[model samples]
Target: GGPRTQLEYRYVGYAPQTVEVGNRTMIDVSLEQETNELESVVVVGYGEQKKATLTGAVATIDMQDIKTPSPNLSNSLQGKIAGVISVQSSGEPGYDNSTFTIRGIGSFVNTSSNAPLIIVDGVQREDVNSFNTGIFNNIDPEDISSISLLKDASATAVYGAKGANGVLIITTKRGVTGQPRLTIKVESGVTNFTKTPELLNGVDYMTLYNEARRNAGQSETYSPRDILLTRSGLDPYMYPNVDWIDEVYKSFSSVTNAHLNVTGGSEKVRYYVSASFYDQEGQYKVKKMNGYNPNLSYRRYDFR
Candidate 1:
């Protein structure tokens, strides 16, 4: 029954009512962003350290940002942080070890161990590859509580010898000091490859073969005219085009992962145990190859 303005302003206080009128009048409303002092904490070695005390540059990859579809853990980190380069290198199953480097190329030699030192929990591992690729590749990247990369010499000095290249510290899930907590994670999807290469047809392949023989001064090795007549007009099945890459690659792949975690405890005895199951079949049969560490000897073809 009253003015339209009164109806809109009836439920709100003066501040909100003013904001509504400003919008109706096309006036810009600006306010300073407020930050919480209690929320500003830097992640140090074991726990959160105040951000103000941090001396060296440390970048962290937290859980919420990582809880997405990432087939390779290394691929998840690509271009997400400054000064960190993660390369998938190869997609072969067991060998899908991602190589990481900080800043740029710091070593003179290409084959030199240019990988950053990887530390898990409180222990330092010789190589990130020391663990099975299957273990790290399939697990939820979100399971990682935090991944802190230490780049400067000041940050690298603590571990000494192994820290020469750089340092990467990884923290896994831990118990919280509250009521028993449960986390159920589930992901289902399909993956496939595209843009494959083409192969030569029977006629073209024979033409190339004949030309090679003629150039090698073996004119009689291939009867070009007869070869063309025999293959040119035949069904494709009679002269099958074998696309090796396609023959070895699979057209369809799917994965399903589910995990359940339980944790909660007092200061003295805290415990965490999680069991996960992962099954992945590749386009290639020898998807994962763990070759001989060191070959004892090489035998001739039938000499064994």
Candidate 2:
């Protein structure tokens, strides 16, 4: 008969509600606190703030999403975060950390780097791309609570010129209001190249060389007898066709990571302590005797 009316109410911290006013003289409504994801806390360049209140671009990642078996935390950031490009140049055991660029490349100089500013627990770190003195790779992924990327002008505003490139904030887990909780994780895995390069063996390499010489109207470097000898792989001292790849490198290597962390405390004094162990073997090998270890390996232990 009459046009129906409706009322909607919403607030920043409270849930939104919609009510219809039909054939009712009086209506009572109760509003409860809203659990908005925008209200979740995130670490910024200087401090922490709610995502809803942030002016610049900020991206956060869940700890569960980055729980990878990789020894370097940067390796797990690939494909997980937006505007973040991670390029892993090598799979070397201890030097496998990915090169990170937020949004895009931050530098044009060859000597300078394009890595984002890495801050751990409010302390500024030198460089994430350091292969010799790498501090970022040393950080255990288990101890990290959250990682936030300040990806725009807000990044520059927070830390001045240093943040011009981008800011990668890593917040470690702190004590919470509860009993002492112990977390132990032991993971073992095998690391390997996704696709091993197929190289031409001695026979193929020699034959190809001879073919190229004939095409160029030049004398063949390898003769038919040489090709046959190489194919037969006889008398390595004379007609040697060695598979250097197989001799110097293995098919795959093993990796082991173990973490032990404890978090607990009252409202007054909170505490979070952790110890982590990481062992990664290189995909390299050499001749050895006397039970000697001629294998390249990297081992690290962290206490925080």
Candidate 3:
């Protein structure tokens, strides 16, 4: 047996356990907690129940379910969640969030129609009608932990009249019991016009116009010499052959997204914090005046 007075066992937030004069082979010790602390628990508007036992029509999705490069969280929800009808009115960077509905439109009133109640961390967010940033929709997708869609009345009874349309609950990531963990994610890509209208330059336009005139039994409007001059690009002022699309558009625009996060905590204090950035360049090629170019871009930064 070893001496009992020379050893001490200490654990943070818990009372120390001392093994005094043990058998030297095996010992059992239970360390009591010095302080009580709150732990993580799942709580819906009402109470939580197993999926098999759930009575209301509620849908849930985890981070893996709606993961995408899109900064707009709503954009990634389309086609991924059941009973969710997601529609995007525009593809513009900041305006790309989908205007979604749960179980389709429930009201015919224009102002209140089709808009589901958005709740983040148990607080209701304002209903948004415009393309501007939606409080819940603009949340960093990586910062989100889970989302729930309360489709039927039974599941959303607690929300009362506000839940007439439906309810969407978003919960952000929080700290867990572990050592501090750092994570970094980066994404970069380009976007190009999928399709564009075919247009004719000066020479082709004149040739086609002259052919049409000839088919109508009329004289040629543009002389062959003028057409040749336009094709030769000799005098842009008098016979300009300009392709506006080639002038207005570039090959592609850039899109970038990044996220960095750290999560760590002791049993009594757990925390999750993250920062993210999203930037999208416009497709239009703007001309520079002097040395400065007025380029178009959309940028969003999020910290949680």
lDDT of each: 0.58, 0.80, 0.77
Positional deviation of residue 91's Cα in model 2 after best superposition, in angstroms: 2.3
Model 3: CA > 4 A from native: 1-43, 105-112, 288-294
Off-target runs (Cα >4 Å) in candidate 2 are: 1-35, 105-114, 130-133, 211-228, 231-234, 288-295
TM-score of each: 0.65, 0.76, 0.80
Candidate 3 structure quality by residue, lDDT tens digits, 1-304: 4565434677754777766754455556777876431122334577555554466877777578677778587778878778766667777767767776665445433344557788888888876434455676668888887787887888889999888788888887889999999999999999888888899889889999999999999999999999999999889999898888989987899999999999999999998989988899988898769987666677988888
Stretches of candidate 1 off by over 4 Å are 1-39, 108-112, 129-140, 203-248, 266-270, 285-304
Report the C-alpha lDDT of model 1 over 101-202, residue by residue, as the tens digit: 666766533233776776767776555433454434444564567878777776667777777767777778777776777767776766566566777765
| Order by lDDT, highest first | 2, 3, 1
TM-score of 2: 0.76
Q: Which tens-of-lDDT digit does each residue in 49-104 have in candidate 2?
A: 88778777888898998887887788988888898777777766677777767655
Best lDDT among the predictions, by candidate number: 2
Higher-ranked by TM-score: 1 or 2: 2
Look at candidate 2 and give me any clashing residue pairs.
Answer: none
